[model samples]
Target: MAKTTLSLLPLILCLLYISGTAASANFIKASCSATAYPAVCVQSLSVFATTIQKSPRQLAQTALSVSLARAQSTKSFVTKLTKFKGLKAREYEAIKDCLEEMGDTVDRLSKSVLELKRVGKARGPDFLWHLSNVDTWVSAAITDGNTCMDGFAGRAMDGRIKTSIRARVTNVAQVTSNALALINQFAAKY
Candidate 1:
């Protein structure tokens, strides 16, 4: 009986782990449903389910982290595109302006992530202030993304460059928008 019990232990543990992971994933899926871009939110964040679990704070932080990562990568890609020739003067200028906006976006998102880490430790009015700061920074980050695209908004903007930049910027913005939605849900529950 002891031998049989020992042999079953590992199998039981494995099953438990699988079930826990599934539960976490389910939590993420349901939480993402509240976002503006549920599909993007789930796709980008589902991989971090184990870390996020069912905690609203964790979910919000993870979403902000994901958005920051996407913003950083998109900024890098746009920077690389600047090295190529054939872009119109205005297009080049727009890219430069966008790089600045992306920088601001990254900085704001970083601040929000750090601020959220403190929200759990804060109480009453302090908690509200920290959460409000996170919300404000995230909203500003969204605006930074939109402002980047605005630099290229005229008829003379090169189509190919415009198309590529717009797509990437729009994606990051959408992802950030989802993060904001998650943050709002977190706030509401508080």
Candidate 2:
């Protein structure tokens, strides 16, 4: 009987693991459904399912981290674009402003991530206050991305440069938007 029980242990553990995984996926899907870019949210976050494990706070933190990474990558791409020669003076100026905005976006997202880490320990009003700070910083980050894209507007900017920068910034903005939505959901439930 002991031998039989020991043999069954692996099977029981496997079943538990499978159930946990499905629950995580289902939780992510449900949380993402409330986001502005639900598909992007799910695709970007599904890999962290095991870690998130149906917790709203974990989901929000992971979303913020993903958004921060995207912002940093987009900022680097814009920085590289600035080195191109023969750009119109207007185009160069636009690139300069965009780089600054992206820098600000990265800063705001970083702060939001840090604040989110603190939300776990706070109680009562403190939790709400920390969550509010995260919400404000994330919203500011989204604004910065939009501001970067705005610099590329009109026919004065190089078509390719404008298109590429706008595309990348738009993607970051959407990711940030999803993060903000997740944060709001977390706040509501908490």
Candidate 3:
């Protein structure tokens, strides 16, 4: 009986050791996966910011091509808030805030792109400078939109509000695509 009890003790210890090792491995894997979310968030933000920065330029170009009366200033285009009928005043206010926040983000990103170019010129590596500029612009656009969308509980609002938000998102997508194209053009030239 004493010998059997001793043998069982060793088996119990071995099982405990194995279980701990597995738990630690699983923990490490989960920690690594959790850390990756911020990086993904940053990348997403950058893409959105880049899109916002490019939208005005594309809109301006289209306006010019069609000979439509152009806004005397780019900032004018930035604040073109949409008015949706059937939305509550509170909903309208929320939408306005979202748009304003997004617009501010776009403006900041545009400035960052210019600043990157200036910094690149001052520094030695031209390629790195251009890449940095593109990265900054993209990051700014995405971050701004995400920030606004984070606050946008308009998903629960009326269909009009939802539709308006969708339209804005589509517009952002178009701008992002154009910015990517512009980046490709720059790359080709380089």
**Sort order, lDDT high to low:** 2, 1, 3
* Candidate 3, residue 5: lDDT: 93
Q: List the residue pairs that clash in candidate 1.
A: none
TM-score, per-candidate, Cα-based: 0.95, 0.93, 0.43
Candidate 3 C-alpha lDDT tens digits along 58-174: 222221211111111222332443444665776667667667756665565555445534543453476656656655665566555555555446446646545556456544533
Alpha-carbon error at 57 in model 3, in Å?
14
Best by TM-score: 1
lDDT: worst 10-residue window of model 1:
81-90
| lDDT at position 131, candidate 1 | 91
State the lDDT of candidate 2 residue by residue for 1-190, as single tens digits: 9999999999999999989989999999999999999999999999999999999989999999999999999999989988999988888888999999999999999999999999999999999899889988899998998888777777666599999998889889999999999999988887
Q: Which lDDT tens digits does candidate 1 get at residues 66-139? A: 99999999889889978878877777889999999999999999999999999989999999999999989999
Cα deviation at 95, candidate 3, in Å, is 1.8
lDDT of the candidates, in the order given: 0.90, 0.92, 0.46
